[model samples]
Target: MTAEFTKRDYSLVGLDSKLAEEKGLANAEWYASEIPRKRMKELIQRRNGPAIRDTAIWFILLIASGTAGYMLWGSWWAILPFMIYGVLYGSASDSRWHECSHRTAFRTKWMNDVVYEIASFMVMRESVPWRWSHTRHHTDTIIVGRDPEIPAPRPPDLLGIAMSLFSLKTGPGEILKVLLHCTGRLTAAEETYIPGEEQHKVYRNARIWVLIHALVIAVAIGSGSILPLMYIGLPSFYGAWEQLLCGLTQHIGLAEDVLDHRLNCRTVYMNPISRFLYWEMNYHVEHHMFPMVPYHNLAKLHEELKHDMPVPYSGFWEVYREIIPALFRQVKDPRYYVKRQLPGSARPAMPGPAAAMMTE
Candidate 1:
């Protein structure tokens, strides 16, 4: 006789959340590759130069592209500049928001906060709420019902995944959440992770976001042109493809509810241009394992940890070749997952059953 299979609850307040507590997965200690304290300290040391230089270039590109798009408006030639602008605003801002939120992107506290808020808006995330949400993500990475940041939940919604490339599915929900927060309301799901003390900040930031968006829309209407919206608001929709492309590789087909970043997160090598846009988040396993390490230093950290970790994907194609198939298989067998293989030098995986019913 076949065993019954129930889909895992991915909700933060659902049955799995309670089960995780019972099973000792919530706030659990995870496996980390061994490294000497001095070497670890060196890798986590904060610096300003790399982020400063990269941020400057990012701003310059956005300005140049936006300017070109404005100049070429009403002509087919404008497509090129607008495309570049969209990617920079929509996609690149994701990494900026992520890195700055970790407070490791810059040495100066205010600089990180400044960029974090701006990038948070650009990425259509409420800064205060998402900061707390991501805190939960790190604390309980991929632990079902506790990780609020699982981009692609299982029995994978392939259509939703496709639509995310253009922000078709998530963009509306994000906008709705912003509008709801503007009215001083928080969704129950958000309230689960966001503390009561921080709720006011969420409302305040949402109002600010609404005001900025309203002003942009007013300018577009008064000027009788869609140009303003394109630069300010629409890019988050149109330019979302690259962000989705690289972001999916972070954990789409990896293990869930495991006490090991090595099992759940993936690190892949990317080209220089992709690295710049993603801000080196391709070193994702390293980031989750050592969240304090600055984006600029992830490569060095990867070298230090690679000997004791599973081999990283050579690039997007190689990684997706493994991921895409697993996602399809998951459509039929929700328990299917890509079980990562540790190298000989690696310590054994933490001894616990995955909270989800996973078949390697």
Candidate 2:
């Protein structure tokens, strides 16, 4: 028998766009749980204090880890420090890039810009293009052909997913994009979301990144050691595991082309350290539901909104248990996806062609 939800084109300039619009899924209003205006105002209020403290701690950890890794270089003692450094440099920077890009992490606009630029370079995301790409992501969520940040496409490349743990395929691909952008070229997909005016900024940021990488390589060559790269260019590869682990849980195995965050996004209860490192992004549903709410307030938002959401997975292991099998099944059945079972207390799933296509 044929699968019910056959794979469709996921690119922006494809049949899915027309399908999405016809089905009223393109730029549609998502269902958000009701909260008092006053309370939401407080929750969404941007503040410098929390972000400043968190950022200072993040930098302190990075500096301390880098120093330890350098002092311990060429010794077994280097392993732990380098590992910590890699997680901070590669994984944590991802959240910082995300939050700062939204310009909601810090009340000060310049502070957000400074952190966004630094974190973008660290995570290998082109600041300007990705900013627009993510804007499209928020505007369209997981509607196929619209959301640029959909991590797992149908008939998922399991090998690519595995390789991304080490940043092998993704790292090289992003570097190639950066190189191309440095020449003032944008990919066809990038052109879909990135405004023409912002193209120059993309080229500028890519050139700056190329120059920085060149300097790091030069220092490594001069010293006849890979130490410089281990600190700079290479950590993004070695230390990407944690970020991937947290990120994959966001939408993998979940419904797509749907307007409900509770259906498409997973919220796993994570420990304090994981929350810190992931920047509370594990509250995935809450983040998607109200993107403007700062990270520090996600937990409170989750508490306020949980009654209307599907029960969150207890933790990472629990979610992975479900996701791993769903992915394995999707390997054989490309149309398959996980349909989250919503609690009775939850609002009904939004009615649409996308919702009708989903199966539990």
Candidate 3:
């Protein structure tokens, strides 16, 4: 028989949610490789040193670059420093937001919260709502109707994806959401994941963000220059490309509604600089497989679990080579996806109740 492809509904309010529940995909138990309890404990150990050091360097570079950009504002030289500043503000903050949100970045809970709040603001993500949204993401992964973070949905908006490289599409929409949240309102989809008790925090965070942006705009008006925004508000848009590149690789074109992370996630080898900037999230499969493990320990975790997982893509180029074409084909054939093949040496995917219930 020809390969079967069904038109899928991605909306939280749609039939996919009921179908997912019936098929045992919503809040399903996922397949995880067997690891000794002791070994798993060692990998999950939390520490403050690495995150503290990395965060310090990140802030220092952001400050230095912002200063240089400000000083060079009248000349073409401003471009270089601003670009550097934007990457730190927009891109680096994303990974920091992610790690800290998991509360795995720092040994101290307060430190993680502090950095999460700061990074959330920098990346224009409201802390409370996004935390819950991400919680659902981890629980349901790429399952249709359950995951709100699916980057390139089927019949993908190619132009929107291209514009998102610079945050042109998502940034404005996120800002609008923040503004709406400031009015103590949330969309129905957000309400699905965000608890009523936490809505207040979302509203408060939105107000703070709105106030900060307003203050920056006021400064720009008072000085008759956009320098304040360049250093603060605008970099989120300009410097978002790197994060987009990294984020898309996590699950784009991968299998959905599966219990196995190896089928749905990617692990790409990255250079030291990229590794540091991304906080080692390049080990996407490892992260999905065991999010409790801290970022510093993901490489070790990858080594331990690699035998059970699909072979990783060699690097970003390897990922893009597969992803770009997959995306192109998906435009015409929404049912098409990249199927990962495991090596002969790889262990079988862990069986779960959900596995038997998987829909075709």
Best by lDDT: 1
> Which regions of candidate 2 are displaced past 4 Å?
1-5
Error of 2 at 164 (Å): 0.7
Q: Write the per-residue lDDT of candidate 1 for residues 138-168, one digit (tens) a residue.
A: 9999888999999888899999999999999
Least accurate stretch of 10 residues (summed lDDT) in model 3?
351-360
TM-score of each: 0.97, 0.97, 0.96
Name the runs in model 1 displaced over 4 angstroms.
Answer: 351-360
Show the lowest summed lDDT stretch of 10 residues, model 1: 351-360
lDDT (tens digit, per residue) of candidate 2 on 179-281: 9998889999998888888899998888989999999999999999999999899988999999999999999987887888888899999988888988899
Q: Candidate order by TM-score, highest to lowest?
A: 1, 2, 3
What is the lDDT, from 0 to 100, of the residue 352 in candidate 3? Answer: 38
The alpha-carbon lDDT assigned to residue 253 of candidate 1 equals: 82
Q: List the residue pairs that clash in candidate 2.
A: none
Error of 2 at 59 (Å): 0.9
